[model samples]
Target chain A: MPAHIKNWSRDDLLLVAIDEGSSVSATFTQNTFCAAPVTVAKEHIASGSVRALLVNAGNANAATGERGIADARACCRAVAASLGIESSEVLPFSTGVIGEHLPLQRLLDAIPQAADRLCSNGWGQAAKAIMTTDTAPKTATRELEVAGERVRIVGIAKGAGMIQPNMATMLAYVATDAAIEQSLLNDWVQEAVAASFNRISVDGDTSTNDACVLIATGASAPPSANPQDDDYARLKAAIIAVHIELAQAIVRDGEGATKFVTVQVTGAASSEEALKVAFEVGESPLVKTALYASDPNWGRLVMAVGNAGIEGLDTGGVNIYLDDVQVVEAGGRAAGYREELGEAVFSKPEFTITVDLGRGDSREHIWTCDFSHDYVTINAEYRT
Target chain B: MPAHIKNWSRDDLLLVAIDEGSSVSATFTQNTFCAAPVTVAKEHIASGSVRALLVNAGNANAATGERGIADARACCRAVAASLGIESSEVLPFSTGVIGEHLPLQRLLDAIPQAADRLCSNGWGQAAKAIMTTDTAPKTATRELEVAGERVRIVGIAKGAGMIQPNMATMLAYVATDAAIEQSLLNDWVQEAVAASFNRISVDGDTSTNDACVLIATGASAPPSANPQDDDYARLKAAIIAVHIELAQAIVRDGEGATKFVTVQVTGAASSEEALKVAFEVGESPLVKTALYASDPNWGRLVMAVGNAGIEGLDTGGVNIYLDDVQVVEAGGRAAGYREELGEAVFSKPEFTITVDLGRGDSREHIWTCDFSHDYVTINAEYRT
Candidate 1:
């Protein structure tokens, strides 16, 4: 029942529907030039209850002006007509090439068949169908007991590049069988995403069609509406765990990524400064290239730390570590640091670069991937 | 008579001397972890009249502690001993690998030899000697008439990577024969640098060894100490022209650079905002890679614009142009745009990306180069 919405040989369309009275919380891209589908989805998600989501890959319905909005609405209308729901009850999502319009007729004709073929076991297939540049599908699941009942949370995301998510990822659908209040779900989604998707960057680019949805189906749970309840805490932990897994998976499968890098900043004067230092190190092209080459180029690390624009940052007080190997101490090459030790650590596929600002106790960390030659090949040759 | 300083196979030391009354102005890196030579040079230049400059390649005495300051002073002392000038009259510069100590003995031994070999024709050789990863030497010259006297301005610079100078460039020395006052020369140097060195970026990394010095030897007649004189204007224009030429040459010879790009941001609410948008688009890895592949990826362009974080930026008013072809209009694909047109423009080795913010009347432009596989190869394999 999957349809080739963009006329590609592969299926590029997906549809997800939930039961009535389900609570949903979603976040969209902070990009001011968000896609048409994002515009439509934001409006529909505001209605408090949504029944379905229509996602199409290959042609991101972004920068298409009024016609793109109309196209998104038409697709939502077709999905609604087949599912016996109002158009506003459906949220729309699109990802892929930006600045292109959707093939309305192909999508319209396939909505009915997609609706008829919808099943609970289609989560795995849905993950594959939503991919654009992702080499593999990203999906995670968590199970917990809430109020003596089984609760399940499943999440699927698709993003390989243009991945520095501001508010959310390119496209993610997280559904939990546990019942939760709308307000709690909203707060949980924001917190979960902030600590997960927001802490990763592939190329430091924020996409125009990023969206993350959290759904509470209320199909198998003792509904708990109180924020102070133990059930709320349990469910929140489970959801955040799933989100983190998905976020890490995205980084692991990042486009042309050869290594997974964790940049941790400590001893900053403030949490904001720590995060700034961490991201400055994580997203630095020089640092990422060195990671790809498996080179222990600690000079670039110290340079990135200085470039973080920290006010009154005492260079004499900074220290950097490559995993357990102390590479830089007091802003210079550590006396005990050996080239072979640093090289051994950088040769790994995963490593952490810890920077102590020697300012205060604040700390933050972010995950990133190395810049590889294939990164150029994938992005440059990508027709989209 | 050039001598090896860092013990490289080739000569790595350079010396330049001027008359006793020469007026000198200089700018250093904004990086908090600036090199030891930068600190030493700051102190020396504060004495108002510098007689000589000592430059060494193959090692940046950066990230060194108090030892680096002592080493820099020792080198200055050697230069001053050979030239019979005070130690404070000699400015020192080091550029190459970061976080390494200088070979103080070799540098000291080379100072007398380098001073003995200093000549008017050493500019070209000095340009080549200062190079690290640069494929070619960067040198520019301009001649103009000031008060019916011919004045010559010549500059030499060396930087292939670790660019994005905040206040100055990575090692540039410009000398003019026209006489100018210290304060006027200082103001001219700042204005000239802001328009030249500060307007270009190769890797968006500000080096800790960045230094640019402007020297007026007071050798020619008609010493114009007044900023309002016609001679001052003529000399200033020539000096700025030479600075622009050297800056562009650095970008043209950027490490692994294949295409030269200019990003122009216009119609912003302020020059600062316009510059921010220009640098954001110019330095975006996605945009640079697309330029490398000759792919007309306007989607990435808009994404970069949105990522510039201009508060309340009206996307509908944004427009982007690839050379003469308007790729984006009103925040969307222009109605008259064609894929082939964009491809044609991108395939060129030199082109401009013009972003019209449509906000106010401010505008700014910057020069950059494409990020290619060689960029990764060069930086990743750099031993330093």
Candidate 2:
């Protein structure tokens, strides 16, 4: 539906109505100044049975104070009325320029149109409609046979900038046609999100409206949702796979991103320390720009590692590798390393940088993108 | 002295020799992979009677393992031989690309030339000689009357990228023509550096070769060096003022910088918390990009504050200002704020962003530069 909420040029409203008796679980941004919609959605999801999700792009109803909360509730009520469901069974989400009030009347007038257009194959359109700076729609699907029944999981996500998710992405929804209990669904969603959305960062900025929801429709009644069942394990793997693909798609479509890179850190004192080192290297602007230029600057890499503030980190015990090419050993330029070798790795569209701390048996990794001139151009001209 | 350490075209060596009784206090980078020169300098400065400083700008003797340390000590020995001082009394410093071996023979051949060129008026030339990616030299000076005697403080610094200093800048030298006790000078240097170099960040990457040294010539000894003395206070203020001027100049001349910004966080639970919020706002890429474009993006400002990870922060009580223009109040857009007002403020080459947490009485501030297209270009092509 073209609500003309942000402007008169684009379609920007999407509503997803789940089947009755579906179990829902979600995670929201850890930002203290979370958006009004996030607050309302959290309260509504407490009942554990969400029937629909209403998302509007172009104006994130955030930093708008008391009136913003009321506006989010009003939109949820409009969607619920159109779907013939209670208001408490609907969740509302908004994304776009923050610190703006929602266009209530315009959004309300389009709710029925959105409900009228909803269909089983609307996932692609929904992904595009919820995009702010995303260059393409992100959607992933996985299917498997469990207990002689076909189980399917589908996921969609939308984000470009402000892309460091503390607990969730800017906006994501994963649905599966397999019966699962609420308690188990909650644990599975957290585990899937941890291995997927939480491992990617386009920029280090976390948004005010990040949220990821998982719905178990129970339309395909699998044999069991118990932890000890093979069916449960198979379904969980499919869900995690779909979530990872959707998360990777968000990074691939990141605003002005030219290259996709993976930062892998190993042999740390703990997983937390390893993550700290990976993030420091992944998010360093100098390192990102070097990646963009394909310079293979190991100097900036070592500088980023030194800046990670790992306690009692022995610089002499650290080593680094670009894919399979060993660039650094014992914290210095490897004797056999050549500039051309590193350049070959960094010139690729996607590559991984691995750092070995040589301290313990812990590891972590994250995916990120290079910083380009176009990144500055897009963000500088975003609100204009 | 153009020793052709990095290349054949540039003059990149400097030497400073002080009077016999000069008291010196210094700080080194907290980076675990600190440069070989930093390690040697720390050991030498511990003697409390440093006689000379040797600085080379072309190649940072960092991440070269045991050979790097030996090369740094060799350079110090050469400088000491030329100055007719103990090698242990000479401190060595290097700045430029990291993870590279120093050109020991070339640097040794130039030691005599550097010593011959060391004049009292070479501060400006020394500043320019120590630059790597910096486009301009940074120097600051102050003169005051202490105990009816004229005293002077002079400072020079060089840094452009990889400049989020943990304890000091890439390289800084400060000297005073007053009598100062070693203990007093040590305390004063820490205090001055904390308020100056520690409060600025160009990028969030810290270097492996950061060092700051404070020297007292004791040439104009007409007053007491005790902290309780008025003369001591007067001289300390002058030294701090010079340090601040040099620090701000580094930000003003930050690589590819078009604007200089100050982020001030007030009403935090403690000074550390205030600094955490200040640096979060100061170094946020989205905020910096908006600043470069001269856009009035208050939403990014609020988002940065929320992402600061301040425990139990009440978002509703936060307030933000662009200079005197109230952009945000009570965690939302200010009732009377106009975009034009914020635009006017951000359009200036220098501006201040103030955030009040409304939780306590503590405050802190930091200086930063905007992220521009050239920042990416310069870092991408730096080694090339």
Candidate 3:
């Protein structure tokens, strides 16, 4: 991530500086066994005017009890002191092994160096520093004309499994140089995440340290705050577009994953049911492995939908398709569908599965990666 | 699995006939998309007298719409006609591929042969006939003395993945010659299954065709039906023991499995919470793969427990052990615990993970298997 830092080193850390008077909105994981840094970040974000994000990698500082929280606060204080800012204004983030305390002294020593190295170019390193089992750093950028002003939005995220809606075990940061209200920023962060990071699965194991933060420097001006305004719509679209790209990148580079899949479930009775069906297909080990092997095993999709525990689900009204190949229609193998056609579509690295429950007008979609042997190799042999 | 009938054949079918007036009790998958045969079996079992079980493997008559139900009825009628019994006295079971109808003529032709081959010593063959991706046929036997009358119990089950509680995508048959009332037989079947077939998992997917049936031929006399009666208790204990053993055998031979694991969650606020914890650990891909590699990655267990969605879970009150080696104490690494010790325990073919939530008296446990490369290979490459 950092040229000066060892690529294989586990003691990775990053610092993100916010311009003076900048507004910040953040979302923290709701898991009870949250990392100490998550607890610290939540408190600091609540302080209203967060100055920076001080992140450390290698040890999650989770389940270390009270001492872990103390260490997290200490790291924040170190960063805050160096920046001449209040300790409560600094948010801390950590990823990597859980249940280990922070190397407090070593971390404190690095804060000054991390701050000294901070620059606009640091975005690349920042993304790389957050990775645990991830193979590559993920970053996305979008430029939109807001109120005739050049507005730039950049987003970065790191995740490799231990992912499932409810914020997925990931750390994401998005910063926009556009003037926006803090309350609106929080709402937009929630909205963007719901359509992006929140709709992806790598093994359906939600981590205990997921956090996403959005910062607006207010360096560039936007036209309006009204929802129906074209300028507001453009800004929101650009932010979500960048977030989706960053989110999709995580699924593409998922641990041990070789195929990127999208599960789209529509015509369900409700959004929740549709989401359940989409996630059921996306997160199913059977379905993921089939995609890994490029095997057109459509039956597993049926099994997953059935197991979604949806009340009064009518199998007879369900239809499934693998890309353009109609594999299952009206709850059975499509009349004209051949095994070879199904195989042809599945052999691709990217494909979409469409499931129509034929009940109502609800829909949901989720991105996922296949369960491959290399994923087992990376996760099983690697300590992350 | 039956020779002279292809082993690689997906068209799996079996029939077990009892001497007459046999009392039958059964459990089916609670998954909404129950197969046609499961629907038929439930109705026939309700008829109060089940003389035979007509099971088909390979083509699971599921999601085939109304035609699937008709095929199941046709199968039952064929078996009944050949056995010279009422069609309502037959319970049908189907396993293997979903959304495919049985080759009606071929299956009907085989029913006569299956009935002809039905003998007192066909328990082994019956077990073998029900296998899908299972590496080996699973069977267990129990002999007990009730009211001075010797009773024999034989149980057989076949499952690998798509295995979850209630009752898992499996076909298990347990037959006993002990005299018991039909009503008590149903009650005992539910109780025994709850503790046996319902406490093991190979994967979290619940199949649409899971069925477990218990047969009491009333050939030998057991005393009374009351729970206080020693004879009834003895008979119930013997049946459950065999059922559990059969269930465990399935896990031991889990698809791509190299290690058998027992996850025991204790001290939860409620039994449901404990079960949620146990299943979370058992079904976690990270935990299973770590066990597959014999790696002492206890953090995955922490991640799983934290993500179990348990309300107000206290990490500080948690303790974990790998077999006799305590890895976690009060939610952190034990003072005397070493990675090598955990490695030694995990390297074994079988081990137990004891998680003490340290909050309440409720407890639950489940049997599981490690996820391995072979599991991915078998599930991905093999045709279901």
Candidate 4:
């Protein structure tokens, strides 16, 4: 179910809190050019304790040298001191234009006042402040019956471009009130992200400041069964579900994106080969432009697959389909292929391109969006 | 020099002749999904003695099954019968919309009449017949004084997209009247093409039918001195000069090309690494679009250089320049860098991007064109 809680232009009561005895796990971008906020947050997360998070939009605070790091730290100190907690307990994040120095005095001056305005009711506001170019703030909540205890799991994320998970530029924050161990939560979050965020590519660029943190406050009543029992399964499922929704939202809001295109490669000789072909097909400008124009140019797809560095993919074994319509089979055009039919398939706002390598059993599903004039316009004028 | 003659539209007889006295050498696409033209061309060129070339535009006889082979043979037979030569002497080339079967009957009917209309002086006409989406036909001629005798070299080519020199769908024909041995001519042509045709890219796609053939009639009088003297040097230079002009014309006519861009990477640890960084910079859409918009976004250049798989490259030692302006220096933005200055540099219709890796001394060069809306337009609706 989707909820509408828009309009956060003035209210700044967005404060994150874990009611005490909370467990936390997080992962950040692996890019060597990571931003100052990402560096500070990861160091704080290493202590496995995060009581609150402060985030803002309009300045990415990346590539600004040592001064940027000092700005992020000062922000966390201001927020923590106002809340009467140790400075290490507060985490801060920023998103927006990179390579510009942040206005630290303004952020430092604002956070103490923001902490005084903290309320759990401001989850909606927290979602808004983290948004950059996203047209809508993405939020997902799930209720899970875990060993007779109901657990409330919610998540929020924001991203538009410089996205290709390793970890991707997209940032996700997931919170739940279930009692779980930190090591187990860490393992679970990594698995969930692997199946979701790691599989999507917006423009094949990995950003320098991508971070996702999952915090469990353990405020809910303990499970009726053993902690190591099947009771953990329900909470894990809930977290994975929320992650999927957030991941999908990021793809839908991709920079200058108009259509969401899913690429599913199946029957590859190996998962490596399947991923190679899938990435090639997803990244090809020719295929993306055709997708933008709503043209079912399957030849571009075939060309990309052929160019992927696979040694012995049988062209005869390749099969391509736009949705359920078979466009290519048995190494060539389908018997009744029609341009108009493909055009109709492409005209839809969303579609799946399923390619059967027909080689083995491994498969991969990659999510991507079409290349549009808007994408070029956004990136071409990004710095400006 | 450029010339004009009649015989492009298939109807004047002036010095028409066909002979299988010249040997042929070619390299075909390595893609397993290669089209029928590639398969047949490999067979025909293997035996050498490929003197006659029968080229047509408007339909690429590829992926059309057995009928493709028969149509190619029929086209050659028609041309050979008209000129009273063996059909085996004629090697055929086709360019244009691929996968559509060649209308063999229409072509076969037209070839005999076209051969009857052929004229030795119809260079312009022959050039026009081989054009697909090219806005203009290209022709180049050079005369050199070799061994006290005048040697002439003439060449023509056509290409726009589906270009990646693993022999892109580039078609080039060169005719010379130099008294060189068939073996020496084949060696020289390969060497010339390596530096000319094989080094240019349009859209980074390898076409199904890319051919560069040289036919030497050995009509020039004997040399005044040794075969291995400056006389040979002069003739080779003339041949290479013509090849370079033809190759440049293809790049100039690249699909939706607005400005011709040359990327030169030097001072790498190895030529392999130099080429790696050169291609990485060349293929990056961010760099290409920035070049298209003439924005001089040097940050994207730095990112691309880092992403290129060259190890031990000191980011601090990296330097970049657009023509004469130092855009990036010492691993970061240069001092006194201003957006307006970069804008001024990119405003030109043509410019050079020079990158110094600060490793050992190695260099490589690549030619490309700016990506534009027209490029998308041409490729997206290409088949239609």
Number of the predicted model whose lDDT against the real structure is largest: 2
Q: Ranking by lDDT, best first?
A: 2, 1, 3, 4
Q: List the DockQ of the predictions in order.
A: 0.73, 0.84, 0.72, 0.29
Q: Encode model 2's per-residue lDDT on B273-303: one tens digit a residue.
A: 9999999888899999999999989999988
**How accurate locally is residue B283 in candidate 4, as Cα lDDT from 0 to 100?**
63
Q: Which is the leading candidate under DockQ? A: 2
Q: Give per-residue CA lDDT, model 4, range B1-384, as digits (tens).
A: 111111234311112354445435455555556666666666777765565677767666654556667888877777778777777766777776655667776666666666666566877877776777677788899988777777778888888877765553488888877666766876878877876777677767766566887767666655432456977777788888898888888878888888787788988888888877887677666677788788887766765675574666666677787887877665556676787888887888777788898878999877777767777787767766
lDDT winner between 1 and 4, please give it. 1
Off by over 4 Å in 1: B1-7
lDDT of 3 by residue, B229-344 (tens): 87777788999999899889988998899999999998899999999999989999989999999998888888888888888777889999999899888887787999899999
For model 2, residues A200-232, the per-residue Cα lDDT tens digits are 888889999989999999899875577887777
Candidate lDDT (C-alpha), each: 0.88, 0.90, 0.84, 0.73
TM-score of each: 0.97, 0.98, 0.97, 0.85
Better of 2 and 4 by DockQ: 2
Q: Model 2: how far is A310 from its true place, Å?
A: 1.3
Tell me which of candidates 1 and 4 scores higher on DockQ. Answer: 1
Residue B216 lDDT in candidate 3: 86
Instruction: Report the Cα lDDT for candidate 4.
Output: 0.73
lDDT of 4 at A124: 69
Q: Give the Å shift of residue B70 in candidate 3.
A: 2.0
Model 3's CAPRI class is medium
